[model samples]
Target: MQKSLKDLKVYSSSDFPSYLPKLNALYDDLFSGGKGFRSKLIQMVSRHLSLKNEAVYLLAQTIEFIHNASLLHDDLVDRSSLRRNKTTAWLKYTPEYAVLAGDYLLARVMVNLSEFGNIRLIQYTAEMISDLLEGEWIQDSLVGEWNVTLEQLNQVHNLKTASLFKWCLRAPFVAQETYDEDIHQLLDEMGGLLGLLFQRSDDLLDFNVRNYEGKAILGDLKSGYMNSFAAFLLQDCEEALRLKFKKAQSLDEVKLLVTPDLFERRLQEFDQVNQESIDLYLHLMEQLAQALPEKEQGLRDDLIKLPHPLYWRKR
Candidate 1:
């Protein structure tokens, strides 16, 4: 399965416009750098449901394209100069080209999904695009708004991050003509929960937690941008923790807030809250798995085992 997937990737890369070498390079660069988390999740889920051969490729392609498109736009929004230890698309390519390339990938995702002739899948994808943009706008609006609530943050994450995840599960079932409303609802809840956890974990990467590599430590703090995690932590946290967060206006201020002991305490607190949420979501995932096609229980099992090493996955 992995080999076949890799081959498809090669095909995707090779399909680039011949006259646009720079655009092709940009596509290849971003594609190779990603963690492939969503792709992996979709595969595991599809296998659990015993989805047949031809369908999987379309699902995989749809997801990878959607993910890459979002990243291109995100980097542009963040003005991020780097991603995956390399210059971002907007940084490496001109902003115009980066946006164009992202748009191109999105178009390809649609054309690819059309192979299924699944109108529901196509419609969902269209809605997802709008949701992605809506999420970004909401998040951007909350940038300097220190009072951002967990409810508000999750709502934004649902639109931006979770919607695609919800699509991953639903699209396959929709394709199979076996759409179970109950299971679909459960999966949507699971995806939404997972997105919140995933994004919160991503936010920690920016805090320099566990001496982590990659994400620029204190980057969000420095940017006057409080992330979902920070927003959660700040909500009714101890006075000192709240005060420490409030003091941070930029990266330097964030750097100063993370003394060694505070870092340790911060992580412990995060794990406590994070684990509770993950466990709740995992339960929802298991409930959703009950609706899986009979032959794919193993895939359902994998869903439960997911997000492995639960507590330390973030650290």
Candidate 2:
């Protein structure tokens, strides 16, 4: 049986040099609390392709490093104080250490990929990292632009969150030297939809819709970043409510208008508008499950389970 994500060993002292004590410890602390969603996604896709466990584990580690590295940098950029319900690396450790630690992880990813001796994997991962950073920059530019449209928000999420998902689904095939263009394209679409769903679900948590792991609520609004849920809700609302939300300066001010009654109504409206996205996510997964040559129904079963609760649930 494949090891569970919790049991996957991502860090070893041998991977790091003895000189960098802060970076080493920072990685240990950051990796400990994550549920390893990215890696789990990779494992699901790999099983469908019948890839070897050794290669899957390496790809898992590589993607996890990329994901966590982004979190480290994201914490610094967002000035987030807490992550996974603990002090963020940038705050818990020095900001310099946090930045360097992110760099170290990216560097390690390259080294491992190079040792794996796959040119395509290296190229694809490099592009994914670039896409993630571009998304970060675009999101930073849009801060305080409360009138941001759903299309713009989709672009940001596609790059920032979905790029990694795209890579996770496609990388196993790349590692195995499979060049099926149609399968790769399908996986890309599936990953993109999954990323959008995951990000939007996460944004809803800011409204206290659900606390998957006790994440901070209203942090996006507090930081002047309008979340996807708020952006979608603002689109169809009355002008008075729109103006009220636009003029408010803090989370509390927004809260006054987004009362329980108003929130409930808007939540339903938000779901109504985005129902197509939810439908597409399931559709793509079903398509992939049937399209794969190997019959790994379990992979599709696990993937389906991930977003089941995110569609319409309040908690």
Candidate 3:
């Protein structure tokens, strides 16, 4: 039976031990006001299979725990002040508390998975976590590297962002003991494209393009990080312009350096390139439909609606 969204709670107060001081309060803040999109994705995929309700919830909670744990470490590493429009966990609680909380979540994931008795799921998740750490290390190295290319950023995105998406698509099937290599490979490719599109669209937000969310503009540039769109925009610029681009403190300063017309043009080009990716993802969906069992064909419909809204930011 397909479960309703309301029936699925990825985080519950009872899930963690109450004896740890401030841990519950910290988690209450951590899990609140966030999108929880990854957990929802897990539920969406699991519903199409013969997964029991308990198994579906476990998968959803596992992904959320892993993702939020990364965010806790990331905010501290980047010295970020805010997440989800609130003070970051590292600052709100002591940095030590934040680190411990994040580690606890990961530990709990292993405990829960072990109780569930799925060795493959536990191994796959551990590998994904390692990929995330590797990606973060590479991304930190790219800071202040003005000449970084989109290809390089994509490599980081694949490991850091796409790994989660791949798990979301593949893990539910893995839980059901479906070890079909071709299906998993196709899902992996689709997840990579989705991660690329989502990250690039988020990069566009830094430039205020379709930035309905009103994210602080030029945060990446000011932080000495050249996001995907920025790399594409400055790909062909001269050394002098690149130097000026790095010093930009505001969006207007960015526009002044690149010129308003060229900025718009580069944005259009960036969107066009990503549109091609969206098309490729849709094509893969067709192949995925053919590979899935007839009863599971409806899963494609739920997934097909993801790319356009994810990239275009127009749900």
Candidate 4:
């Protein structure tokens, strides 16, 4: 059965161990703060198959575990003070606690996956963990560098951000006893493309936009990091413009270069790259649609809901 936001919200309302207040708090931090985008993915896919009742809880929990684990480490690495509008784990609690909490969540994933008793599910979850960590490492290596190529950045994001998403689309099929090679590969490709689109669209938010940038704008540039979309945009900037962007040392310099005027100019060049990325993401989702011969009604609504949010994101 497909779970609703109301459903998952109610299901997850109870607190964890009272003795482990910090751990419980960590869980709450990630759980309540985020919109459960990935959980939505799993829910959508589940609609198309005869997914077990247990699959909903296990799969939802697994996605949260993977996401929260990454967030704990992400905050420490980014030294970010705010996440979803509050102090981060490493800030409110000690980094040691954060690390342990993150580790515990990952361990919990194994226990959660075991409930499904599917080796493939567990194995895919394991591979996602590896991919997520590797993606983080690659991005970390690029920190403080002002010029990362679009292809390299996208490759890293695909591995890190999309790998888990791929799992979201495919796991339900695997769990439904409806596993197929083509569907699995197609879902992975779809997840990667969606990940690319989501991340790149998010990158545009860093430039300039009205109302729905969602997060802080131009935060990436001020921080001296380049995203996949920005990399494409930067690739075409004049030598002098490139030097200005590369030489940026503070938020002021970033504002001067990454203004509305400059961004609009760059959008022209970003058109081809943007189209390519859109095609990539759409193609993946298309494959998923094709792979499932008879999707359930709830699955259909969920699948329809998938693109709506992604489409409205600032670009």
Candidate 5:
């Protein structure tokens, strides 16, 4: 039977060693606020396969652990004051504690996977983690670089963000020992599209466009990071205006500098480009449906509903 998300407990105090109270406390705070989107994605994909429930839970838990670990480290690196409306881990706890907690989660991921005894799954997950670090390194280098291109940001997003999505798509099949190369390749492409659309939509939130979530406006600008939307908005701008754009502290300032007309035009163009990716994803879903066995065809229906919400931010 397919399980509802409520049935899955991806994290609990019992999962960690009780000897270190601080570590547990740090994690309790860290994991409590996340949307758990990636883990849910794993469950969605796994339901189509014939895998055991234990295997599905393992994959879900693994992704959450890796993702939350990245967040722990990311909060420290970004020096952000808040996450999910609560104080960031680095500030709430010591920086050293935050770092140790992040490292511990990653270590636990490997330990859990090793015990699962799937050599291929273990190796692939390790590679994904490596890609995530490489992405972070490249992203850190791009900070304050106002001239960074969308292509460059795409490279980082693919490694850091898309890698997780790709793993979510492929890992369930891998767990079931379905090693069909074609199926994996299509899933890879679809996952990449999903990640790009998601990241771009998130970047839009920085500009407060369709920002239903009320995320802090201009956080990326203030942080010296040029998000994908910023890169797109600045691509055609002159040097002086680009400099002005970087200095924007408020949304009104950003709008004034970019001029409301140009900003709207660029936003439309950005949405159109992302819409092309959405169309491509749907096409890939058609191909995926054909590659999947008849019994798993229902998975395509579930996945097709993702791109619209992911890119459009419609809840």
Candidate 6:
């Protein structure tokens, strides 16, 4: 049976002891009110595999802690003041404290995994975190380079986002000692595609299309990062427009480079591409469903729901 989000939260909350009141309070604030979407994803996959719920809870908490740790560090790196409509940890607490807090969570993850004592799982998770850091470094280096290709953007997201998704899907099997090469490969592909869809949808949110919350509009533009949508659409634009875009340092300057007609045309193209990607996501979901064992056919609907727009929506 699938665990409810509330149940997931209970597991997450009980994972740590309140030895330090300040740190505990900081974590409480940070973890409170989150949708626990990643944990939910793991639970869904666990349901499909009929894996042990207790083990799933631990893995879910591990992933969520790592994820929140990344966010705490990310908010500091980006100098973001707000996260999910609340003041970021770095700002509410101290930057130094925030850094340590993030590190503490990661250390806790290692300790938890060490207790679990699955060498393969630990090795894979360590590799995933390494890949995620590399993605962050690559994306940071690419900032202010407006000519970023769709391929380059995709590669970064594959490491940063898809890696976690892939782990969520395959780690349960790893826990079960199932090591099925075919299923692992299939999950990898599914995660890559789903990551692209999620990242692109997020990129779209930065470009004036209302979607997920958190980030401000044109945040990427101001930060000198050419988003996936912009990178793709810019490919079809003339060299002159591209040059003008390259010279832009702010969202206002970017707006000046694009006429209303051009903007509308690009948005239309983006919408078309987004719909195609959605179709592909659905197709992949269907493929996964067919490939799953007959006993797990009931999971098809739940699996499909994982990537549904409703799940992705913030408001």
Question: Which ranges of candidate 1 are over 4 A from the true structure?
Answer: 1-3, 6-11, 236-267, 308-311
3 or 6, which is superior by TM-score?
3
Off by over 4 Å in 5: 1-6
Local accuracy by lDDT, each model: 0.73, 0.82, 0.91, 0.72, 0.92, 0.77
Backbone clashes in model 1, listed as residue pairs: 48-299, 222-250, 222-251
* lDDT tens digits by residue: candidate 5, 1-315: 754456687988999999999889888888887899998999899888998888999999999999999988998899988999999988988999999999999999999999989999999899999999999889999888989899999999999899999999999999998989999999999999999999999999999999997888899999999999999998968889878888888998998898899899999999999999999999999999999999999899899999999999875
lDDT of 2 by residue, 139-203 (tens): 99988887888889999999999999899889988998887787788789978877887788888
lDDT string, candidate 4, 145-189, tens digits: 656788899888888887887788877877776678887787677
Listing every candidate in turn, what is its Cα RMSD in Å to the true structure after a full C-alpha superposition? Answer: 3.4, 2.9, 1.7, 3.2, 1.7, 3.2
Expressed as tens digits, the lDDT of each residue in 71-163 for candidate 6 is 898889888888888999999999998999899988888888888888888888888888888888888889888678888999999998878
How far residue 235's Cα lies from its native spot in candidate 4, in Å, is: 0.5
lDDT by residue for model 3 over 1-315, one digit each (tens)? Answer: 654557577888888887865999999999998788998999889889989888888999999999999999999988999999999999999899999999999999999999989899999999999998899899999889999999999999999998999999999999998889889999999999998998999999999988998888888888899999999999989999999999988888999899999999999899999999999999999999999999899899999999999999964
TM-score of 4: 0.86
Worst 10 residues of 6 by lDDT: 4-13
Q: Tell me how many clashing residue pairs each candidate has.
A: 3, 0, 0, 2, 0, 0
Q: State how far residue 248 of model 3 sits from its true place (Å).
A: 0.6
- lDDT: the better of candidates 1 and 3: 3
lDDT for 8 (candidate 1): 46
TM-score, one value per model: 0.86, 0.89, 0.97, 0.86, 0.97, 0.87
Name the better of 1 and 2 by lDDT: 2
lDDT score for residue 236 of model 4: 59
Deviation of model 4 at 175, angstroms: 1.5
Off by over 4 Å in 3: 1-7
Residue 197 lDDT, candidate 1, scale 0-100: 71
Error of 4 at 132 (Å): 0.6
